[model samples]
Target: MSQPEPGAVVDLLGVLAYAELTAFDRLAEDARLAPTLTGRAALARMAAAEIAHHVRLTDRLVELGADPAAAMAPFTSALDTFHESTRPSTWLEGLVKAYVGDGLAADFYREIAAFLPEPDRLLVLEVLDDTGHADFAVREVRAAIVADRRLAGRLALWGRRLVGEAISRSQAVIAEHDGLADLIITGTGDLAGVGRLIERITSAHTERMTTLGLNP
Candidate 1:
């Protein structure tokens, strides 16, 4: 018989599976706020990509002998809360949220994946790849900010709010999921290492803000 998968690995994949699925939902909703047909189409395409990634994660969960639904259940509340709390009120805010949230999650997951063995690490990184939306967000947000200089300040504040909400939700999730916490601690070799990991993620977020012409 095949050996059972590690709990930490299952936790990682489970959370990611739910995250991708919710991202699909969020993007589809955001697409409705698009000012132009082209913008709507772009977000629609990105939403499709999110669903595809969700399927990939669910498939891997099944192969590991876990029910995809059960694996994702634990994360539903936390992720949902995060989304509801950060729902964008405007088209530009939606675009900024997508860009900033995706970047933050990608950075955090990439750091955690470093601790995972072989195929799991590869799978996590693969699903976390950009769904071709970053450049679109950058172009859209920057153009809007140029037309209305006040938007730069507003979106900059929005970006900071997104980061804060994401990090807070993540910490709650980590505390509740011991396996996930252990994975991070083990991968980092200690609490201090985990701090460094957060620092790196924060640094990446600052760079993403700069790329969008927003204040970090």
Candidate 2:
């Protein structure tokens, strides 16, 4: 595969930077839904990391001489649509959304980071959510499922919907942003590679759901 043009990387950097900012905002808002003080604090810490990522990415964008807001603008509509459509109805559902939804996104970013050039690639890899957040989500979600077996179906169904909406928006991004698509393909080789990436993400998500005692 040919190397992506410098312009494409710039576009990707913008997208990534904006994505981190918005993710931080959403996670911070969702943190309010946590049931306990410890859970809330855990989510707050995760949100703080996201904010730090946003700051780093934004600084990188400035270093690249790109307009950070403009770079993020193109993604705003579809991302807004996804969040609006998938708002959690309960505290447990919120935890599920944070864990399952964001976990999948983190995996996607990690896969895509492999294709980026240095500094940018390293930044992407470094910004991923830590295991502490994942462990907290898993513990909370599993406890909920165990306490009430009936929630398994509902949470599973919600998880599937979150994944579906995520994929839909992802396709929208790929379709509308040739630069991002080029970056991904250039890094991963071809359509098959992207499919494998998605498969790996889905497999991880399945394990997460199973760990929570929910059928995937």
Most lDDT-accurate candidate: 1
What stretches of model 2 exceed 4 Å from their correct place?
none
Candidate 2 lDDT over residue span 18-39, tens digit each? 6777676777777788777877
At residue 76, give the lDDT of candidate 2.
81
User: Which 10 consecutive positions of candidate 2 have the poorest summed lDDT?
Assistant: 128-137
Q: Look at candidate 1 and tell me the lDDT of residue 89.
A: 93
List lDDT for all candidates, in order.
0.92, 0.80
The positional error of residue 198 in candidate 2, measured at the CA in angstroms, is 2.4
Error of 2 at 49 (Å): 1.4
| Candidate 1 lDDT by residue in tens digits, 8-84 | 88999999999999999999999999999999999999999989999999999999999999999999999999999
Model 1 global lDDT (CA atoms, 0 to 1): 0.92
TM-score of each: 0.97, 0.92
The clash count for each model shown is 0, 0
Name model 1 segments beyond 4 Å from true: 1-5
